[model samples]
Target: MNSHYSVAVIGGGQAGLSMSRLLRQRGVDHVVFERDRVGHEWRTRRWDSFCLVTPNWQCNLPGYAYQGDDPDGFMVGADVVDFLEKYAASFDPPLLEGVEVTRLRRTRAGVFALDTSAGRTTADQVVIATGPYHAPAVPRIAERLPAELVQVHSSQYRNSGQLPPGAVLVVGTGQSGCQIAEDLHLDGRQVHLAVGSAPRAARRYRGRDTLAWLDEMGHYARGIDEFGDADEVRLRANHYMTGRDGGRDIDLRAFARDGMRLYGHLRAISATRLDFAGDLAQSLDNADAVAEGIKDAIDRYIDSAGIVAPAEARYVPVWRPDSSPSVLDLAASGISAVVWATGFHRDHRWIEVPIFDGRGYPTHERGVTGCPGLYFLGLPWQWTWGSGRFAGVAQDAAYLSSRILDARRQRFTDEVSWLAGTPTETYPQVEWWAAA
Candidate 1:
């Protein structure tokens, strides 16, 4: 790669690659820097049975959509990597894999400087496309557990075979937590799951997948700006369901009825003993409510459109805790392994920019920040419900590409005007629009 370029994309994932493809199409000099080999995250972080929760038809990259015969089916872990690989090959994006960018800061020359393992490089603009799963957010209580008991963050977990021969206690009920718990449960390894307040969705309803109906309602296309409570809504835990075994709802109540022990939110830990809040019933009830709520919306949509759809009965809770377990002795209960499926937080500390809020989340309108020459991409709800997802990232990336090109043009015009004895202009503070 050259010492500098018109733009630098600091990730090689879907977002970064999409950005690269757009820039190349526009004839902009750019490069994509990936910290690891291709498919590193998919290969490492995901369990063996991991698959896309959404259907394969939703994998819409820039100019490269899914052409597989099984568009209605879910692409497993390996299939996902292959699709990305083929997309990259289709365009031959300028990418440098296995090159980690250690830090990024504004240079004295008003450009961006990226310090990487290879060396330092400068660029006119930088797009941080590293999606937000940087650091795992395991609870501190994990440290108090017995040293002999195997503990792995949800990212590190592979399969029940890798774990010791005993029961597995999975904490948290987000998508990852629920899916991992199901993974272990399917292996017939007596599983214990700690339920949280994450909502749930139906796998299929009214003779079609729930996602299909939602997509028909234009839910995926709605922008985050339409919401009155975007902040809380953006951070809300994703509804838990699985695309495994030809797509099915992970009914924790069904799991409980099938002999898997379910508990409420984990409260605290003491040595080998663990305490749980008596919210198991409430948690299950809340999840069911959300799932039903989605159906309610879909039912309304069908009625409004005057469509003839088969009616389905609302879900009834299959099992309930006769009495919520308030406490459990890990050693006595035979839980030899614990999987902390708690969610993760973004770690942008390496980016020495002041674009973050007090909580360290990047503040931006869409992907364009107030800070000139700096932008963020692939963030949760960055623009819409699917902003960070495959269905919507291409749109987000295209928006960023326009802003990047606009900024480049404005910078050029300003520099020429300044050298010609006109007063220099500070970069315009842009919000959802390019510099004027």
Candidate 2:
């Protein structure tokens, strides 16, 4: 590939590809570097039954919106990979697959230099669009689990048949944990779900998809300021639901009703036994409270907007016995696999800049980093609640591309003025020089 580019976008996912499309349109010279193939995570990391949590209609990238037949339907894992591949093809982006960017730092000349698997590359500007969820964050207790138990992260999980011939313990109560638990339970495995504090939402509310309601209410457009706390919004857990089973809601209560074992958060794990907290009832109550809050917000929005909507049936929380044991004999339960759906953490160690916050997150103003010409995209709550979603990454990408272009134009103007031995203040109109 090229040794130099005007801009280098790391990661060939939606964010990078969207930026590539916009940069191409603006006559900006750029290249996209991918550690693997485009949409590598969607192609490999996700499970077999995985589908988009969001609707198909919301999968909007720059210049590429969802044109498939089913706007409301959810796309499966492979279909998402195919969509990304087509988007990459649409622009013929200068993407170098199998090239991993190992190091990113500003050189002495004020340009960003990247050390990659292929070779060294330099750029005037760099957009780190590698996304937020970089690596799986399994709890330290995971290491103490019995060696015989097949431990797998949610990303490595593909299908129920991959696990050994026994029950599965799915830790965490977020989307992945709930979906995987449902998957295993449906596949005839006696499933045990360790519950956490994840809010639940009905897939459909008041005769419309919940996402559509959120879109109409501009919930997706809400920024950290709207939430009143950046840390709270950034650290908020995703709701417990799924787009699988044709967008059916995966109620944890429903799981308990279906004869699946429910446990509190996995506190400690010994060789033969696993200890859980006695907060199962409280956890369920918290989930129900949050779920009610969401429904109430929707109700208020409907009333405020004066929209004619039918009353929707409310979901009742599933009740459990108050005297359940906080400890379980893992050996007797025959759980041979442990699925850690504990979410992910970002690893920005390679980035030599000091823009990270106290939580190790890159500090940026809607994608532009504190360091000039350095940017980030596909970050959660970067600009809004939807910033990390498939549709929202492109919005950040488009905004950042404009910033890069503005800086590029100014630099070109300065160069022309300096070459002509004219003062930049006097020769501000250098359109002809830029064109030439």
Candidate 3:
């Protein structure tokens, strides 16, 4: 509600909250503006059974870490919400929930001006921590589907019971699609899945969870710069697996073996019919290949270190589609619902800055942008694999907080120099002189 702040954090998620904790510790003047309630995505977007794909131990904020008994277990959506609530309570961050910042641009004076739902305000610096997922990416082809058929983006989906009484067609093979398909299948509903090229990962390897192995192997800490082509790495899809049912590999082949219909990438949808690419076998094979590839890397790490661990066998496909079904009659199959888990795209149009790339992604190093006093956080691969994730956001916030303070100090030094050089009569009524 203040007319101005030294720093304005543009989200109240883990990223913004972590930055607030650090700035608080450093005695910096900052406020967090959240468009919705804190952790709204975790509280609402996910399904009833939705749990963290990562282990609880990985849920580390700036000062708060998971201290529950089940460090190895995954936290469900409610658990995640509770964790964030507790973290916020611990520090009691200066957060304004339900206050949306609709527009942000640098004023003529070089200060950041924000036109929020409440009113206009300005800040010396702004941390755009709204994250990358803003728009649900439903394909335009969905318009061709019948008006009667139930359709919902993955974000709107909650559980199988929410769907109509009939077969379900889930499009996409990413984490959301796969997990939703499994949710429907387990509830005795027939599920037709349109698989994509998203890779899969092993749930566990050598008697240890693959994530645990990766954490120890320093995979999460590997910076994006470590890759030869960081741009390509940024565009890469995340390896899909599940932490549902206490964490397990989502073997699509096994799902097919159990009568869950599988198809290739969804190409088109005609009246009463749906078309798919003839690459079901390739998709499945590629997913398994990636999963195995991760296992191979873990094996090499264990061998070189001589780490004693249980020996585990590699995965083999349990079932294969006899024929690539390229088309399906929607009416005859009794498919009454469609879930579009096609993922999300960034929506930074509200930000009137010119720092975005062709894809509308902010051009930044770590979190600091080329634009002075502008920064970004909670972006996938922002610095490392865990940069956007709870496991790594603390480090990113710490680094960004230091940068913020450095910028603040530089501004103060410049102002002092200007004041000293100027005549004593000028700036006599300086409103912010005492704060300095």
Best by TM-score: 3
Name the regions of candidate 1 deviating beyond 4 angstroms. 422-436
Q: How would you encode candidate 1's per-residue C-alpha lDDT over 83-134 as one tens digit per residue? A: 8899899999989998999999986667888899889888889999999999
Candidate 3 regions with alpha-carbon error over 4 angstroms: 423-436
- Residues 296-347 of candidate 2 have per-residue lDDT tens digits of 8999999998999999878766656555458888889998999999999889
Per-prediction TM-score to the true structure, in the order listed? 0.96, 0.94, 0.97
- In order, candidate lDDTs are 0.89, 0.86, 0.91
Ranking according to TM-score, highest score first: 3, 1, 2
Per-prediction CA RMSD (Å): 3.9, 3.4, 1.6
lDDT of 2: 0.86
Backbone-clash count (model 3): 0
TM-score of model 3 (CA atoms): 0.97
Give per-residue CA lDDT, model 3, range 1-436, as digits (tens): 8888999999999999999999999999888999898889898889998998999989989889998999999999999999999999999999999999999999766689999999999898999998888889998999999999999999999998999999999999889999999999999999999999999998898998999999999998899989999988887888888999899999999999999999999998889889999999999999999999999999999999999998887787899899989999999999999999999988888999899888777889998998899999889899999888898889999999999999989877877776777753564422354455
